[model samples]
Target: NSHRVTYIHNLFQNGAATIAGVSEMFKERKRRGEIPADEEITFIMVTGDGGADIGMGPIVGTANRNDNVILLEYDNEGYMNTGNQLSYATPLGHATSTSHVGPAQVGKQFQHKDTIQIMAGTHIPYLFTGTESQPQDLIKKAAKAQWYAKNYGTVYGKILAACPLNWKNETRDGRNVVDAAVNCNFFPLYEIEQGITTLTYDPEAKGKKVELEDWLKMMGKTKHLLKPENKEIVEAARKEVERRFKRLKAMSEHPDL
Candidate 1:
């Protein structure tokens, strides 16, 4: 049977909650034995940002026990179709209707949610993460995920795509955004196989550490976070980078033990 459920988080948009509710419904059906134990189920999560579909991560985490979950994150940080409201995926200082900048000038006060980390922590049997910019990598990850699902029972994959309008960039510049992501190490092209994390394309394996400026320059919204006058903000951003590196180090040390 096919069904769709909608979840509304503070009425921000219908995308996130919709995906979450549908997954939940299927799980409920399976638990009650309403559906045959052998029946196969697949949950498709579609959202613009990491924050909108936070529910999907855990659902995939739990549902992977008996089903397949595919997550797609459109790089648009805000509610693009809904008057461009700021979502949790919105970058640190992007000016949105909800986060308007005044004379005092402060944009979204919070950093965007890292949905990848949330899913990675789940330690699912099969997890694949890639960006749409790398079509080859994306296809490879998707194919492997399907293989795992068909043969091993469950799989989970996440893809990141560019959102030009939300990022105040031209649609024609989508490729540029992807290139920036690679150049800045903001979005590396990689895949997780059978719970093992491996870097697929490490152009910087021997290169210098990616600086915060690389990401900030491409993301207009995050530019304010580096205002020279705000020493505290600058230091905070640096600290965040250091913390991220540490996490990556930990992941590298143990991919799927």
Candidate 2:
């Protein structure tokens, strides 16, 4: 049988209530014989800064309840649609409208939030990271996300997108910028299935891994981090990437994670 899909956009904070209400309404209609019981419907919500920032609490609650929904996050590292203000997803030492770099402030002072890992804590049935740089991998993960959301429970997926305007990179270089991120293991390709972590692509294994600086140097927002005075922040950012990848490696080896 084929499943019917319904797409909707809501404010990030309202996503959980909207999905819970809509999905239950569909099911209730089926129960009343208004729709066939076997007829399936999947609800998908697309959000950016809305979900990762102010809307996070409700998102987490929905995941905790195992709501039947697919939440896809388009992470451009800032609130791109709203003037490129810094969001929780923005990386440390990255300059945004709010996280300005000057003699007083050196970009954002804190690290970016690991929203994917945070969602994993909700014990959702499926969650993965994807980007346009790896279309095939993204497509596969998306299909899997839909399947899990339809037959199992909630699914979350993150796409590390590029904002050429905000990042101050050439529009034509957007794809390559994202590719560099994946290559440097700054944004690794991976998925967590029912708490079992798996690395979809390993840059180091494929000899494609580049230093964190390689990726940082590609974006204007982060180029300042390369300055001698900003070396400490750059090092911290590098260490954070290594720590996360190492933990992910350990988890992939130990299925109990």
Candidate 3:
């Protein structure tokens, strides 16, 4: 059947959570044959800024049990459609309309949510995290995801798109900004295959341990997170880098039989 069931969660702070709920609702509907089993089901999530959209990852994970779910995270740092409010994914120091800066103040104090990591934790057979700035990588990953969904009947891919308004840059500067991120080794392009993580590109030619400065400079929002005054935060960020590299090293060395 060509009929497509599209669920949109609007004005709701937790859109992802809403999606999860709807998936359960649909499951029941499908079981009763209210919707034909042979009909193709597609679940698509669209959100702007902030990872506060709860239930999104879980819904994708749940939907994957019987259908394919595609998740897209736009680069909009502020809630554009909803009066430029800050979402959980907003970076540390960006001056969002909701998170305005004043005397003796920092912008958004918290770091952005790592949705990729959250999705990875689900251990989905076919999952990917991509950015539109890297067109070739995005296309390749999308193709792989589609193939996985077709073969295994479940796949999830999270895409990162450009947000010129949030970045305070012109649309034309979007590519340059993404290029800077890649060149600086801030947004390292990589992929995970069947639960195996691989570094796709490394411009810095550094060791397994990546320097924190490379990524920090590109994300103006998180600059304050690494400031000298925030010694603890900086140290914590470094430790995270070390921990990730160590884990990757172990995985690379020990392959599954």
Candidate 4:
């Protein structure tokens, strides 16, 4: 389908409000015949990691209202655009400017926020997570997101993007880093449509599963978590990842979920 797409860039915290306003305007225009009835203009709000953190309130409001818009969050784990400060998305024990590692404290203290589950709680029309390392998976999710936004109500999506600078990793290793994250179940590929969950890619089933510590070892920020002193923290994060993936797997198996 040949549809018009309108992209708006704004503060992550304001993305939801912007989309809501623009979507309403377009709907009114179409209703008044100002815009051709046959023409489709999809509204997309592009947000960053901060969106899932500071912008979460508006996002929940938009989702609850079932606004006709697509919210795309490029989550690099921390507030990469703002000097790599720790955001709620940053995993436990991951070093950022705000979350320092020393004898006093070791990286982030608490577990990271699970934005996917948060969005799923709103029961939006569609929600999914994708990463650039898996191009096909990302593309398919994008297409599905567009379709849901057009036919249903709100669609929320997250892409586990790489911030080489913040991650303290070489730019050339971006794909490998994200790939490791997927194989380690830190970022599983999945989609939830109309409250029905589906696992798009299963690393365990494909014999591609790797230990969570292996993924952590690939980046400097999280390497401390692998230390014996910080073993408890890394183990906690690993358990959380496995728990989430297992829950998703169970959901995918049950149709009434």
Best by TM-score: 4
Candidate 4 C-alpha lDDT tens digits along 1-257:
14344455677588898989999988899899999989787788888877668888898999989999998898899988779999998888999999999999999988888888889899899999999999998898889899999999999998998898989888999999999999999898999989999999999899999998888888989888877998888888888989988988999999786
Give the per-residue lDDT digits (tens) of candidate 2, residues 1-257.
14344456666468766877788788889889999888876687778854568778778878988889898788998888778899988888899999999999999989888888999988899999999999999999988999999888999888998889999999999998999998877788999998999999999898988888888888888888888989999999989988988899888889997
Residue by residue across 76-150, what tens digits does model 3's lDDT show? Answer: 556666666787666555567777665565566666666556666766656665676778888888777766654
Question: How many clashes show up in model 3?
Answer: 3
The sequence of per-residue lDDT tens digits that candidate 1 reaches over residues 205-226 is 7474466576666655556656
Clashes of each: 4, 0, 3, 0
lDDT of 4: 0.89
TM-score of every candidate: 0.70, 0.94, 0.67, 0.95
Model 2 pairs in collision:
none
Candidate 2 ranges with C-alpha deviation above 4 Å: 1-7
lDDT of 4 at 41: 76
Minimum summed lDDT over a 10-residue window in model 1 is located at: 1-10
RMSD of 2: 2.8
Query: What TM value does model 2 have?
Result: 0.94
Question: How many clashes show up in model 1?
Answer: 4
As a whole number from 0 to 100, the lDDT of residue 181 in candidate 4 is 94
